[model samples]
Target: MQSTYNFWLVAISFAVATLASYTALDLTGRIFLLASARLRHAWRLGGAVALGVGIWSMHFIAMLAFSLPIPLGYDFATTACSLGLAIGASYLALVMTTRARLTALRLLSGGILMGFGIAGMHYTGMAAMDMTPGIHYQPGWFAISLAIAIGASSAALWMARALSNDDARNVFQKRSGAALVMGIAISGMHYAGMAAADFPLGAVCGAANGVNTIWLAAMVSLFTLAILIVTLMLSRFDARTTFLVGAVSKLNGQIIRLATLDSLTGLPNRATLTERVERAIQSSRRERSLFAILFMDLDGFKTINDSLGHSVGDDVLAAFSQRLLQCVRSSDTVARLGGDEFVVLAEHLASREDAGVLAESVLERMRHGIWSDSQPLQVMPSIGIALYPQDGDTVDTLLKHADAAMYEAKRAGRSTYRFFERSMNEAATRTLLIQSALHEALSAGSFTLHFQPKFHGGTDSLVGAEALIRLIDSKLGTLPPLEFIPIAERSGQIVQIGYWVVRETCRQIRRWIAEGLPAMKVAVNLSPRQLLQPNLVAEMLAIVQAEGVPCQQIMFEITETVAMQDAPKTIEMIREFQANGFEIAIDDFGTGYSSLAYLQRFRVKQLKIDRFFTNGLDEHGAEGSAIVSAIIALAHSLEMDVVAEGVETESQLDILKSMQCDEMQGFLLGKPLSANDFGDLLKHRTVAA
Candidate 1:
């Protein structure tokens, strides 16, 4: 006798199978994205229970739908065993589908394994009937049922992965269509297995005391449907929770960045620096080891800002921050304290020399510099290192000492690093005093120009004078250019001091002419910051014209370093100044690395030999006399006059005269004089020849 399926009960079984399949798809896809193994394992186990019950309930519901022609009830022990097989099959499906490195071989192999597991579950459920003659399966229908199981299992695996990848659109439609196909596959295989069943006409149910069939179908269907629904709802909640957690983490990271990083350079800010230094201090104290805090300030960064707008300066800063990050170790932390000042915490250092090594590396890299639109801008860093335990124990003290050392580095001419010294704090205090006095001196009109006259080396007649600014402060008392100029430059007062020098020189030239002194050219030195001023030439010309002084009567003196700093820019500005009939001279020549090609390009009126070379002239076959002779010859070849400055003795003057130096400016001829005294001397021609 053959068993038949009830169409209505069959529809219920198919519906249950469809829902279970859709839940399996949802469960596997969501579990794949979970980062926690424990959570995923919990979900996998829960999914297997829900999905396995659904599959088992659909099988039993369909079995209940079949008209057996004999009163039948399932064996209690076999029926329970069938449920175990179903749950095991569901677990196998979940595990196989969620592989990280899913490939064709794994997918094919997984499908076969899952297919066999499902068939085992179905066959075991058939055994739960336990008829008198036992339900025999026809070979042909059995083969067809197994084939359907395998093909459907493969199709389900492929569809689950594909739908997950293509989930951006038509989400409901895609899952629904897939669920329909899965329902048909499961129902067809079950019905095919049912068709294979050949129950004898005289068969009797063996398990008479087993569960009754009357309410079992309704109970299993409702129970399995509830489990699937609850599982799907929880899976949806978990997915939303995961998304919310990820979003919150991302927002928190951005907030942290805003609080701790410099907005302009993206380096750590001062707060972060303090925190890192504190951490390092704690760690070092525990380990009884050393670390270093490096405080760095960019040399001449103000001049760069004053010369080429702040925007370019910002670009340079950003680029160099990246370079500094690259140059340092991963254990080190770099921070921007604001406006050209930065700090680095070099942790786990073995010796103070290691800090020096890092500073040298930074200095070497900065020598090459970052290029902005073809202009190689130097980003020199004056770094000061303060060691842990040796320098100080607290963050504030270490930072202060490092800052004092950095000020000392700048005083020692920048482009270098210095370890913290106790004496530098006093020097730093003095620097602050001088800076304060500069402000008062500027307001009180205590700045005055002293004339240092230059004479013809051959005729000993005064040719011109260099106007040097002197500061007369009651508190600081008489300070020369060397005593305050560098400090003034660092404090950004050089530009104002520079303008004052130009205006005073023009006024003194007018006074001298009024006293009947010839309108000889008087040179005024221009600071690097002054030359970078956009309207420097125009402003100085206005001062001279207002004084009713001829442009030829004024000359501008720039250091060899300033002239060679940015060759093309300096040459262009020199030409602009010369166009207004003002002569340009390279002051302190041979003190800087000057390119001969660039020197020719400069085309200035004169070169003022630095006093360093002039001082060594008295020694026989001295390097100074040889260099001086070569310089004078080179100057004449280019039609440029060579002025030997800082002449103090007849021997030095005679050496310059022997080298045919065109002019001399030193104490040997005349000390720097007051404007009126210089005017009187020029008017009376009082110097002895």
Candidate 2:
């Protein structure tokens, strides 16, 4: 009992002696943060210094609780070796990163610190020299100290090994919290060992002796464990809240981008474009500067999309966008208005010519042609330029004039640019007036079909008649197909217009048969857009059956260019039409790429040579006669009939007859007239023959 009391007294003295050194080391570590401006790097260096100071403090603090009875030489050797191990462990911990593979650095450092701290504490406890002068060795004290040192080192080293196996866990793992648990466990082991150590032979053993030891051990253990668990729970809850907040911020950014951007082309959409334009207008007005707006449309894009699939069409549009970017300055804003349409806004332009030159550059680059299926495909653009203050002061006026200029550019040959002029507004007004009148024509049934007779050259007798469409506005006397067909096609009103043609043609055929006229075949031109419709053939057949007209008496004509778009699908549709007793004719054969392969594949009834070729046949010095001869011979070999259109002279008719052309339909026979006029001609022909 006297010896233990002396050990406690020496431990207190050693703690008081080391207090000033620990305080100085901890204060010096804070100065490391000022060496660098970067927070993260400075923190890394500071953290290493803090760890070194912590080990130093832990060592001296442990000395206050343990006492040793070793000679000065042994004490010096053990303390030097222990400090050396601690310094080496701290250096190793510096190289280890949370980003690298986990290793035993933490456990090694903790084990080294604890090992030295225990050694220091044990030596301090033994310094009192309360043993007898005989200096008899006691195995019980040696065993107790050895057991406590080995137990504490093993526990710490095991924790370090576990931490080394997983890097993620090491980063978030509660270091101080875990150290607290370990500290309590080690304290319990030390107290239990102290109780087990046998003291002097005369020493008294009492109930109060073990009672104080157990009470102190329990109090320290429970207090340390409670602190550890609460710290860990609070840290994890804070991390989860931070992660959820960051995720919501990212989602909100994505949603905002989608709302303002165009889904298909990734350009600012119409709403966003309008907002930006308004802002530019306001800025230009304040600065008293000029800006130009150019509206561009892809020329012949509809033909390309219809011929190829929409997938290829998408590639062309994307490529065009990239090309457009190369033509404008970085200050300009370019946006896609819709399909094959784009608009550019250029600020602080010196003149409208600047916008025109940019538009020309875009067209020149596109004219070189793009590749499709490894073949060169041509694409071009038509642009209309409207200057801010020069064309109009308001947004609506600028847009209106730009649209008129674009139409003017299209009228004056595509692949060109046009500047807005005052006169263009008159043309625009005319277009709008025509649009209103056409709508009235559709509702009032003012449009009519004129039948032109088709004659067999060999027999010189009527075999069939082609149904020609015409529109009669109330104000205007009569309108040709070219005047209104394109407008209808653009507005997607051609589908309805086509339906009207079919129903009215069926009604006319029934009337011809009812009037005791010969049962003549009636042919009607079908637009490619109409032919691509899935239910078109069925709808036409239904109209013929409903109107009491024979399907064989109705012939449907489609252009050669339209038939080549999807040859397989076109052939299937033709086969269905033939099965229903409706003859198919390729009208305007030579205008586009007329392929013999497509002709043989589709196997139609007739080919109507375009008027351009027929009009040339009468010129003796021209090569038109040779072209006509080749076409007729080709048709004969394919077992298909031929019809020469626009035949206006006897010489042309005679030449066609010699070429073995099966039919002729032009002004030479009779111009397309009203149905009643054609009926009168039929009566006159019957009497004359």
Candidate 3:
């Protein structure tokens, strides 16, 4: 018997095949978009079941659509086996595609396997037919059918992958279009395989086969349509959920940035800086390398804020931060530690000099100055440097030491840099102690003045005395100038201490004059911190007047380092002091970088040689003697008097006397004495002469 197709049943079969194709593609698309691994696996398995059942149903329905001369019935066991093959094939395809990228190798392998599977299902279902003679397949048509299955399967998989890549855009439209194309391909493959089937003449169906063709076709169609509808609904829900999750993820990223970045400069804040430094430390420790931390404070930032207002100040800060960023490597971190203070963490340093080079670059860049609006701003950087495993090993210790070094840089005269040293930490501790003691000592009158007399080298007569400060604490005993003067300068207590020294020295001078002591100028050392004060000259004149001491009887001593810092300002202050009959002397003359021009510009009355040049005068071939001789010649040429310091040995005194040095003061002449003791010395010197 020859089979003939039923037109209406064939159309119904095509509709069922189309619906199954759309459902499978929709489910696969949804599975690809799922975020959770567990959910993706679950959905993939579920999709395999739906697709397998749908493909099986479409095939069976098409089988039911066939008409023949004899009745055909399917064997229940063989039919169920065909269904299993279809489901197994689908599961394998889903697993293969989901596990890895769909390379050409994977696509070809999956296509061949799925093609053989579909062919097996079709042939196995054909074998389910129980008739007088079993159904057979034409060799040529079978080949055509197999070709259709493999080609269609490969095309469908490639399309699915392509559509899923566009999931971020109009995904539903793309997937719907993909589903339409896949449906046509699957239905066409099914029809091609159906056309290969051949039944012999006079075939009769067996009673053991209980397949109902019409009812089975209707039931399969209804079941597939329901699955397709459910697949569509679930896909819509998944797409919406995915959009919300993506939005939430973006929001979380923004929150993270806000928490870690500075609002104005957009650089990392202190918290983020700390975290990055910790990470850098771990990396450096693992690699056995070094890193440096630089603490920077903007000089004259307060002046900018006061003069131009904070709005302009903020602009300057932002501009400066950008410049700073340009100076460092991308691997390094630059952070703002609030208001005019910034820090940099440089990692993976090959040597300590790398940090120095970077610091020099920063100084050079800032040397040109930063601009705010149209106005040019001049702000310098005072940087303190600390190295890992050398200065400190922890974040807090490193930052603390770096901060202390930064203050040291500022104290060394701003606009410079300093490295952390072990002694700096000790000095910092001592500074805190002295600061505490200084306040109490100042209040309790525990401070006393001592005078070291300066003598004329030729006459051996007293010419002047230098007033030195001493701090006497019940707990700490007496602290020398080295111990307390630096502490006072750093703590900003020098202004008060300097005023007290001037007042007491003047009062003592007046007392000596009343006791018939010959009048001699009393010299007081002025700290660099005091020289920067605007009222220093005025304060000294007022103290001299209040104590009834003539201005010519008092002299203010400033270090060469202090005077050379701002030459124009130093010259102006010196001229004002000289105009009022107060002598100005440069103490520690040879130790600093003061030029001969500055000495003449200030019209200084005297030059005091630093002790380092005088201490070694007794040694033969000592460079100290050569330096002392040169200084004496330089001072005399400028019409300025020379006083040699630290003259302990008679040999040093002999050298100075031969050099025609005007005066000498040290332990050899007389140690610094109490005011009463100095008065007695003066009286004895008068009697001796």
Candidate 4:
């Protein structure tokens, strides 16, 4: 008897087979695109299970649609074996495709194994049917079916690989189209295999009875649908998870940028600069190339900031940073070290001369001035360059040496550049030594005060004295103020040192008063750093009060440059001091760039003519006389007493007396003496009186 097929059941079976094929191809394609090596294997295995079981299920379901004239049933063992073969083949195929690049050999090998496995499954399922007379196949039709299976399997593998490749565009659309083609190919192969089998007519066959064909078909369809639904849900979930991961990665990158970049200039910060320098060092070692570091400080930035306000200062800094960027190559890094200080790392430099050229270019760019709020503000750069290998090896050493050279440039004059030299290193070493020694000196009481007396220019009578610090270390004996004062200021030890000076001056003055000596105002010089101390006025007053000295008997002297550093704050501080009965004097008056208007604004008691004008008064002729005369006249107009500093000769004193200068102090009249020597001098003067 010939086999009779249920047309509707066959259609439903093919529809189910097509759906399963589409679902499997889509899953396999996604698995191929996975970036993680570990996750790819797990996803591929899951895909193999779906594809293998679905293919086997489709064949079995289609088999149930066909019926012989007699009863038909399946052996449970044989059916299970066919399903196992299909899954094993799928696993092998997926492994082949994903293990390496999809070359022709790999694709062909994988396709052959999968095709043979599917063919074996179809024939094995056919053998499960219990019939007295066994079924046979036509050789020609069987060969055609086998060919169809191999061809369709190879094409499916190729299509899936193409979709996974990065070069492919419109991946989703292409993958969808590929799925439809795969479904058709798989369904066609199944039908061809079914047609290849022949069931003879009038054959006496033993009927193996168990489940109905329609019920079996329904169960397989339901199972295939469940598997497909699960696969679809998983694919969607995977896509959502990937999108969330990508979004988080982008957010993290933004946060890192914010941390490493300057908010105003948008340049790298100190932390980022340090990291880049380390990286550059590594690269230079590998490439055997040289690099340079440039440390730049904007000269007079404090003046501009105080005069024009911080908002304008910010605008100027932003504009200057843009110009700085234009002066360097894109490969170089520019970073801000906070508060008008910037650093540049230039990589792959040819020689030290290249660094010089870069430094000059930076200076030239800064000369043009930055425009802010419709006003052009001019600021100059003091650039200090340190070369790789020549300057120092490590980042800290280079930065330290470069900063030392920058101060050298500032001392030479503003608006210049200086290359790091061996002398700078020596200076740096000395500075470090002084800083270490200073702390020890402060604790050990190695520092003492020396009194330099001022005399009335006309009468040559002792009037007052200036308190000077002397550090007498046992080993380093008698270090001058010039030797360690700058170091103290730079190391931020000036504030403590200043307080000591105030307390010691008060103590000496109180002792002199107790001895029945005439009370005279004693002046103490305050460093620029000390002037910036927030509690300066209160701290000094407390020290003087604690030592039982009258405020009027002590004078606080500051240089013009120091007074103008933060003009408004300086004015307020000076007012506070004056209000407390402390006298304020401008020391080294003629040397600093201060306007007469600002000088007049100060509620000061005295102005001391700087030493440079007084030293060569007899030799300098009219120019010297004119400057001294003008200063005395100006001081008289401002109702402030004028004190001539560094008056070393009788002739200089006569010139100051002629100019009506109030007082004079120098080595010629009285050398700086110990407190005991000053007391003896006072005693002798009292006896002379």
Output the number of the TM-score-best candidate: 1
Tens-digit lDDT track of model 3 for 1-689: 56677677777766666666666666666677667899988877777777788778777877888767666778889899999888888776676666548899898888888888887898888778765576667888889888888887787677666665435588767766766776676667777777776666666777244557678778878887777667667766776788788889988987887889888999999999999889887888898899999999887676566545799889889878888887778888999989999999999888888888888888876787453444454577899999997888889999989988887887787888898887788767766777889988778998999999899988888888899999998878899998788667655688899999989988888888899987768898888777767788898889889888899888888899878877998999999999999998999987788688878888899999988888868764458678789999998998999998888988889889999999999999899999999999988884213
The estimated TM-scores of all candidates read 0.74, 0.68, 0.54, 0.60
Model 2 segments beyond 4 Å from truth?
1-237, 240-248, 275-291, 298-323, 326-331, 346-357, 364-382, 408-423, 430-446, 458-460, 474-477, 618-620, 649-651, 686-689
Residues 494-549 of candidate 1: C-alpha lDDT, one tens digit per residue = 98898888888888878777777687688989987787787988998898898788
Task: Tell me the spans in candidate 3 whose CA falls farther than 4 Å from its real position.
Answer: 1-269, 278-291, 296-324, 338-341, 348-394, 404-425, 514-516, 619-626, 687-689
* Top candidate (lDDT): 1
The deviation in Å at residue 433 for candidate 1 is: 2.1
lDDT of 3: 0.81
Model 1 — TM-score against the truth? Answer: 0.74
Query: What root-mean-square deviation over C-alphas does model 1 reach?
Result: 6.3
lDDT (C-alpha) at residue 660 in model 4: 85
For all candidates in order, the CA lDDT equals 0.85, 0.66, 0.81, 0.81
Q: What's the best-to-worst order under lDDT? A: 1, 4, 3, 2
Q: How accurate is candidate 1 locally (lDDT)?
A: 0.85
Residue 597 of model 3: what lDDT? 80
User: Worst ten-residue run, lDDT, model 2?
Assistant: 20-29
Candidate 4 structure quality by residue, lDDT tens digits, 1-689: 56677887777766766666666556665666678988888887787777777878878887888877777788889889999888887777677666658889989988888888888888888888855567778888898878888887888778766665433577667767777777777777777877887777765445467567787788888887788778767966886677678779988987897789988899999889989998888888889899999999888676466556899899889877887888888989999989899999999999889999999888876676453444554677899998887788888988988898887787677689999988887776766677778989888998999999888866777888899998888767888888888767656787799899889888888888789877767899998777766778899888888888889989999998788766788889899999999999999998887579889889699999999989759879888889889999999998999999998888998889988898899998899988888887787763211
